[model samples]
Target: MNENLTIIWEKCLTFMRDNLNAAEDNTDLKKLENSFDLLFDNVQPVSLNNNNLTLLVPSDFYKEYIEDNYLSLLSAALKKNIGKGVKLWYSVMENKPAGQEKPITMNMKGKSVATPKMQETLPPSFSANVINPFVVPGMKKIHIDSNLKADFSFDNYVEGECNKFASTVAKSIAKRPGATAFNPLFLYGGYGVGKTHLGHAVGLEVKHAYPEKVVLYLSSEKFIQQFVSAAKAHKQTEFANFYQMVDVLIIDDIQFLSGKKSTQDSFFHIFDYLHQNGKQIILTSDKAPVDILDIQDRIVSRFKWGLSAEIKSPDFDTRRKIIVDKLSRDGIVLTEDMLDYLASEVKTNVRELIGVINSVIAYSTIYKSDLSLELLKETISKIAANQKKVINIPYIQDVVCEYFGIEREQLLSKTRKREIALPRQLAMYFAKEFTNATFNKIGEEMGGKDHSTVMYACDTIKDVSKIDKEIKKYVKELTEKIKQ
Candidate 1:
């Protein structure tokens, strides 16, 4: 009975798919196909005839839900396969097959079987809806969902000057996907700079807008791991086949693929196949394509074929805006002064800024304390200490000179005029504080002044900044600029 039922079920599915494809859809046809697949893959026919066709589902919920939402479509498709006179009946199975370690379904031979847990360990084979494992040959179609993150949508992504262009392009790609010229949108930036966020945002947006499209976001490490597993299982062809069917493939941190020659070689073919077929590919890395080490020139050439956008550290204003948005979402109200303090102090990346925010908010809730500047300072001080600080003396000089509207040479000269002298001293102070240079080196770098003069200049700025708010403000602004 199961053998005959399986054959009839396969016939009905083929008929329905061909019929649906012929009609233009207001509904997502792929989604409907997936719903059909889920039912057919897990459920089986108990009996069939011209007058009535009865099916056995795994549980009562499955029976009822399928009858309510999918009965009409299934009935229509069945009529086309059997006849319009046939009535469809669905009921829960009285007993699951015995001696089964996993969910059991009837294979084509009328024998109950379970997909090996080992096979399930492999990455999902291509399908339209959920993460389903590949079944034995001549069985019903199974679908595994694209592993996109639900929370990583565009609505939550905070836009700033640093990532505006990249965000805009990502949105455009999401709307059109492979139809756009930015087929392989490469996003590169240092840690915590929104590259991964933007990559996931694009995939989520694509899945939301185009339900029929298969969008997969994977880290290069995971991809390599899967490829190695597939090769070990001798299912390399199946692995290649699965990825080839994806509509959009997003690989995060492609730098991780460096030094893995076999993984890179396999990915190169997959990359070529997808690109030639008009599929969209998005990649993220810590560095630009050219800067990525140990990668093949051919693979790097393909990455360069599309757009490469870099997300830099957010400027102080952008960082402040991000904090305001994040706090507003968390229902935490903080003053502008407090926000500015965070923006200026946590000057490295968005992730660290957000980490500090979460920590402080969690601490406040546990202690029943209002969020305050003191709590923020305490939270950020610990985080900032752990973070590696970047020191650039030339950048500091440029910022100081720009603030005073003096020539670069004037900032480095021996002139004692008040304007030049003050700016020069400010430059010296920043060089000593920010860089690893010795006092002698700082003095030599700044107008060939002696070590004592550099020390005096640092002392004078420190004393004046304490007494003058404007001077303090200048130092703070200059420090922030240099950090950025």
Candidate 2:
């Protein structure tokens, strides 16, 4: 038995040497072998009805990292050398070492005693500075800040008709920073859209592509905090200088800058400096520049100088892609039906979608069970069923009329002239499609028109939409904007 165990251990070492380039050092191999020997010494194989071999590790981090990164390779090696159908399990020992030698006996009354503890202990894998040799030399440290989450990137941003154009432009800017025709790009949209994700993606791309470039990515709240700190310390100039020096500036949630006149004034100077120097500036807010409250005209004009795009709430296809991408990254396999259900039900935002997926994964991990569509539905039903209050047609008409620089009376008028009539027809069409009102009711709401006029307006939109792609696109967008 001793000879067989020694031979098995040697075969395992040989496999490791052949398969892993990072573990090529002779000293590292010796240390690993010693650690394995120490671990196996304290864990005697149970003489049960199966041929299962369990290896004990010192920490949960060791078990998880090894399981995720190297378990399959190790199992394949074991099966290749020791015949076949060999099973292995890795678990962290619970009881602390007290120099005890407990006898491990099977139900058959056969017994094996644990070996003595090692004189030199191996370091726990979870220790702070224990570097994985496989990781890139300079990429060892991953710094996470409250304003900068590790998971916010283009990979997780869902794409739909509502936001496809904006997402595409953002990705292009990220791929080639400071090179796009639209310098100092500003993205505006409704709340819960992916404006922040696009802004963060720009920073992430810059860091990954041009690692040497100094990138300062922060939220407006962080900027306010730092600026306040600088003021308290009489170092406002220092803060300004630091912000001015970055190669790229990404500010998220710029809407928060509203009502803070002093902060906005300081920000305007920074914006001007960055814009004049050709440094890429990416800003995201919940409203368009012209609509932002209490913002200086100079700042608003500067914001509009570059291209302005908006990301609307994701549609069904985009939501599904978001779910699939997020789950795939976490190493979770979800069925098509499960993904469809999630995509259809969780239609709010990317963050909520990810939350649901995380919850499902956590439940599965905790229970030591397989993931099923039924389990996912049961887990998500409580959170997903909270219905959002549907907006009425009159509300949409009011917002749309206000947005297009048209009056409410003009929308209900029956004039067929292109300029006034086009916006009017659009209002009527939206009223018919988006609201719970009937044709007669919509026509009455428009301007005391008959039901036939409402039907004609709807038909006119459908016919024009089929013939003119540009008009169709604009109407579709207007519909989405009002709905969002």
Candidate 3:
């Protein structure tokens, strides 16, 4: 009977491959086979009892993953290979928590709770072992909600020339976490360039594959806030210890650690321990490791130990694919010309591209208007006009410097004189206003100024603009000129 089950499972796998790989594309066939290897190769045939086929799985995570992701496929395969109305059962070989082993049975009936549409998405239980190393008291094991959204899967991500290299590297790292040379994979690019999305995607991939491994995704700003909280609560060692226990650590916007000495020191220790122990560490930043200012040299040097891939703004073809993928997922179809028109008009980044698509769809639905190239052109132009300017850091600096009758270098100087200080502040103000740069980034443009320093400068400018009429005039006039 067990031998029969083996033959049945093999036939099922073959059937699956044939069904999924019917396409002539070698790449698609290879991908289907690869997914089969990861998902089904480990599934061992245990026994066949009275219309129920029990399969032995490695872990409970493995069972849940198969059920959530491939239950439909597996069930159909069994019906085709075995017989109708034969259900599948899961027997975990090693279901242990804190050294206690137990057996778990999962009977996936046709009436399972999860809908078919969500089968492709991961279950929240993927974040089973995630715990906040900080803020949780007393218990060595603490629970923290994972920010890695299941919606941020690679299936949802659009692969383009700009991100193809990074995407490939990230998938490789996910398949072989901590063992790959892409340890501490550094992704850098402008805002809305999908850096954070890719980072979350990598974390989700690792979690889906290695559910037993602890994977946590926290932004650097949140890391700093937690560090501050941990310091005040006097649980610094506990915090560090908790983090060191993570098998895969993903930190976004590592540039936010700039100019922060103690946070850098703490993170450096954690990073060194994980790297030495062959655990994976992935970091995302707006700037590359070398360009990240004020971080400790040791930390910066370690960031270079692995791959550094940049995902720039999507190209024209990439943008078009993004639009198609996004709208198709939502089950909304537009004419190819409308898609191409939006693709050409919104060239900033994926975030804006999707935002433009959403706006267009909303307009069409609300006004009951048919999609047209002219309407898309009008809508995108209004968005551009609303932005008021095509301003970046350099452009803001140029406008502010020229307005103040000072050289561009004056605003970038380390030592701010009374004369140059206001101009510098205005530049930061305009940068904050006209660009999507973070405060720390604006500070970097203004010569290594810290986050708080940038906030103070912006505040001072706002206050002075209210009461000081001349400063107010400067703000109003510079704002218009920059918009121009």
After superposing candidate 3, which stretches have Cα over 4 Å from the reference? Answer: 1-24, 28-141, 385-390, 394-443, 446-484
Pairing residues by index, what is the TM-score of model 2?
A: 0.50
TM-scores for candidates 1 onward, in order: 0.53, 0.50, 0.58
Best by lDDT: 3
Candidate 1 residue-wise lDDT, 1-484, digit = tens: 7687778788887777676666566354544554566656777777776567777776543553454446666778787777777766654453344574433333111322322211112234433232222334344575656777776778878887788768867887887787654668999876788898899999888888888888887888888888787778776656677787789999999989988998887788778778877799999987678756678988888896667888977779889888888888888889888888888877667887888788777877898888688877886776667767556665577578767887656776667899899888888899988888988878756655789999999999999999999889988988887775
Backbone Cα, N, C clashes tallied per candidate: 4, 0, 0
lDDT of each: 0.74, 0.65, 0.76
Ranking by TM-score: 3, 1, 2
Write one digit per residue (lDDT tens) for candidate 3, span 1-484: 3676677778988887787677466564554454568767778878787888888787544564565446777788889988899878777655333454545556763322221111122222332343365544556556645578888889998987789778877877788788655677889876788988888888898888888888888989889998888778765665677686788888988888988898887787778768877799889876667667777877877887677888877889999998898888777788888877878776567887887888877887788887777877887777777765457986677667667888554667766687898888888888888788999889887767888988998999999999999899999999898776
- Which residue pairs clash within candidate 3? none
Candidate 3, residue 398: how far the Cα is off, in Å: 14
Comparison by TM-score, 2 against 3, better one: 3
Say which prediction, candidate 2 or candidate 3, comes out ahead on lDDT: 3
Clash count for candidate 3 is 0
